[model samples]
Target: MPVFNNKDITLHYATFGDKDKPALLFSNSLGTSYQMWQPQIDVLQNAYFIICYDTRGHGQSSAPKGPYSIEQLGQDVIDLLEHLDINKAFFCGISMGGMTGQWLAINHPERFHHLMLCNTAAKIGNEAAWLERAQLVRAQGLKPIADTAASRWFTPSFIENNPAVIKQLSDTLAAGSPEGYASCCEALAKADTREQLKNIEVAITVLAGEQDPITTVSDGQYMVDRIANARLATIDASHISNIEQTQVFNQLIQQYLV
Candidate 1:
């Protein structure tokens, strides 16, 4: 349970596999913890030194006040890597983490070898929708949105078939801190990296879930089109494709990183 104290915020991080191997940092989606990456870690750990962390305001990390910025979220990753003495690593992030990955490759390209952005967009949803959702979460709780979110996370067929997995993921979402979740919502609301995508000159791979309602395959294409040396990889799953299609997801990532 290593904690990287980044001034106002504290990030909880974990590492796996051999320290000598090339590093591959996995950043999870919004409202989920580092545990969300377990499926990939189970297989890819042998080839790469895997690093996963609970983003600020989620899963054992500090939940500061509302209205967080994308730069703030991106800085957390930078600080964590610096604290661990990691100079550079391949970054793989999904959803909100993908948004963070965009900022990293754009603002700090020197710190990464490659970027893997999954199930995310340069500009997610409209600011109004995100602000409204944040307001709703602050007023009520994450439980109200948890079920609907779960639906968007996985396909209906997968949800129906994997009852235990759905419950586990949904429960994790429901248990998130309201302030933390809302703060991230604020970050998403203000985030619009469409203009900055062209500036990212790093080798990048953009992944999208075929059935993802949150961020569709078209969104991934938009990123691939903007970045200079980038390509697209489509997964036959929903938003949380890593969990719904673990084997395929793991294989794609391992292939790309190598």
Candidate 2:
């Protein structure tokens, strides 16, 4: 129920674990809330001070005008850290969140000790594809994409076996404001961090989903190849690899952070 007051926007955030522990910030993907990291919080709470926040245009955060930039998103994180009097924290982001992480690691290098990019890319999709999706969501609704979100988010086998998880995520996605979701789509459409990879000097770990169609393993490798002190790990899951392969995801992060 806590919120960080930015100049133009109000961001909703939650924290777990003790204040004395090292800080870890978690950012969510498009169409997801901070709740998406519940599984991670469950395991990491004992070892780290876990911070989770809803991105602008998603969850309870204020959604301003259309088409937010990665820089804006990254700055929000900086603002949040400043609000909490935090100097540095370990940062983890997936999909849209990862794109924001790239911006932060490149422009605000001192803000993070380690950066973990999960199932994301420097440039997610082509300009045309993201634009089209944005238009579709604006004209129709989140339901249009939420209907097939499971397919994009998880493997067919995982979807078949985990109906409840699929339902829960899809519901959350569908509940998002169409305007907010579409604005984020426009942000992703124009976001191209490929050129900034070399600027990231912090220790980095990039994980990709083997079965993911949205952000594949190849995308992860592309990042690791460009960033110094970076390595790529492949998980046997889809775009939402953290959820589909929770234990493996947690173990990889725990090992990498330590």
Candidate 3:
């Protein structure tokens, strides 16, 4: 349990493979811990030094107060890099993590070599919906969201075939801190990078899920179109494509690193 203190929060992160290898940092999606990247770490660890961290308010990380901002999330990454004594690394993020990646690319372009944004959007759902969800989570805790998360996170077939995996993730979500989850919801509510996408100059790859209802392929394309040095790649999965299609996702990431 490697933890680093950043301002008001303590972030938990794990690293794998040789330190001399090229560093590849992973940021998990909302409601997931750094364990969500295990599938990727299993495959890429031999080649790259893989770093995975639980974002503030999730997993082992401390959930401070309400309404975390995207800038705060982005700054956390910068702080982590400095703590590790690494000047730069390749970055990958999903959903809310992807939004953080976008903010980093725009604000700290010099600190990364390449960025992969998966199953995310420049502007996720409307602010009202996010705020309402935050309120609901605060009132009733994570059970309601956990109950409905499968439908949004995985395709019907994947959910049916991968019951164990789905259960583990849902259970993690159900057991998570309500305040932490709600605070992240508030962050997503205010995180809109649609106008700022064009300013990102770092090389980028947008990994879209063909059947993601939450953040559609069109959203990925919207990002690819706006970012100066970005391209789109599609996989036949839903929101959590990396878990749904691990081999293909790993291959794509390896190819991008090459």
| Per-candidate local distance difference test | 0.92, 0.92, 0.94
Candidate 3's residue-wise lDDT over 1-258, tens digit each? 799987899999999999899999999999999899999999899999999999999999999988889999999999999999889899999999999999999999999999999999999999899999999999999999999999999999999999999999999999998989999999999999999998989999999999999999999999999999999999999999999999999999999965
Kindly list the per-residue Cα lDDT of model 1 for residues 1-258, writing each as its tens digit: 888878899889999999899999999899899999999899999999999999888999999997999999999999888888899999999999999999999999999999999999999999999999999999999999887777878898998999998888889889999999999999999999999899999899999999999899999999999999899999999999999999999989888876
Q: Tell me each candidate's TM-score.
A: 0.98, 0.98, 0.99
Q: Model 2 reaches what TM-score against the true structure?
A: 0.98
**Predicted model with the maximum TM-score:** 3
lDDT of 2 by residue, 10-35 (tens): 99999999988999999999999999
Give the higher-lDDT candidate: 2 or 3: 3
Best by lDDT: 3
In angstroms, give how far residue 149 of model 2 lies from its true place: 0.5
Model 3 regions more than 4 Å off: none
Model 2 residue 8 lDDT?
76
Provide the clash count, candidate 2: 0
